[model samples]
Target: MERLAKGRHHLANRTSLLRMISAWESGARDASDPYRLLLCEAYGKSPDELGLGGGTEHVRSDIGLAYLGSLESATSALGELARFDEMKHSAVILGKYMPDALNAACLDWLFGESLADLRLSGSKVTSQDVAEVRTMTENLDRLDRFLGGEQCRLMALRYLRERVVPALKASKTQAVGRDLFSATAILCELVGWMAYDTSRHSRSGTSPRP
Candidate 1:
């Protein structure tokens, strides 16, 4: 625990470390975004894998949510956002940082989980597939830059839900896996930025990009 506090958790004091541990174990304090991240990284586990879900506050939406833990969890959160976009929900949704979720994801990336070889037994994901995704993302980036972030949100969400997520679920080689993960990361960043923009626009009573 001491080592975790000083080295992994970066806690400043022994008393605070013991108190935090006790709180986390006893469920007295929900793990905030930062601490959750430290715990996840130190342990090489997901928020759910470490039985830490109930101990943290969940961001109801990703618009304002700044942190995420693992690719899997971040993907799941993106799925939720896609559903909302599909339903034509309001873009003014607000969110807070979800430490545990973001922490796990950060640790996963730091440990090269995102770069791991993918094992698959189905049709190969070709270089062409990767190129297509890259092109599409570039186009979306251009669109967002010219029109506005809001202009690209729906298109980004659709691409993610219809194309990216499906490809990720399928099997592919290490090369393809790296490309796909990279593409997904780009898409996620685009969507998150767009969402944040939309929220800002809504708050200021300004119109979104047409």
Candidate 2:
């Protein structure tokens, strides 16, 4: 929820700072340690060169995988909850930036026929989808359409992990930057919690938190 200028740490350069700022737009998983570590590496610094220390690429990926696991946990938690108020309150808090995405997510999570259905319901594809289309980025206008909006950084992440890097890997280019896939794992979890929790709370007749 914090702005780039308002986030906890400040980098010495605009590029690194923009990477962090881009994390928010991309989604939490894309911002994972591996991704940030790679980003740091791109900047000619190890993760330790920055304050991240051992927040290496692998470590960040582990974190993201763990959060991806939590998505199911949240779903179970929501299904077992007796009140919508608690859930709704949680969603409202999380919707600070991606309100529409979070809102639709919450609604689908609670009211959907089942958890499996809920999982498949939304278009919360995120910027990772942009990764799939980046090869065509010679057209800047198309790039703008693909990576534009509040979730640009989120989508930008996919461009690295899912689309570009994979293609590069096919040609054996080898990825040298962040493990943005893991970051998306966390992003999905965060939005999942926000959506299910908020919708649950709202359905339970609980007033949203002040």
Question: Considering every candidate listed, which one attains the maximal lDDT?
Answer: 1
The Cα error of candidate 1 at residue 83, in Å, is 2.1
In order of appearance, the predictions have TM-scores of 0.50, 0.19
CA lDDT of every candidate: 0.58, 0.34
Model 1 lDDT tens row, 70-168? 445555555545544443434433333344545554464566434223334456677787788888888888898889855577787678777776676
Which window of ten consecutive residues has the lowest lDDT sum in model 1? 201-210
Residue 34 of candidate 2: its Cα lDDT? 38
Tens-digit lDDT track for model 2 on 71-110? 3443333221212111122232222333344455556556
Please identify model 1 stretches exceeding 4 Å from their true place. Answer: 1-77, 88-94, 97-123, 200-210
Q: Top model by TM-score, which number?
A: 1
Candidate 1 clashes between residue pairs 3 or more apart in a chain or in different chains: 33-99, 37-103, 68-101, 68-102, 69-101, 69-102, 69-104, 69-105, 70-105
**Where's the lowest-lDDT run of ten residues in candidate 2?**
59-68
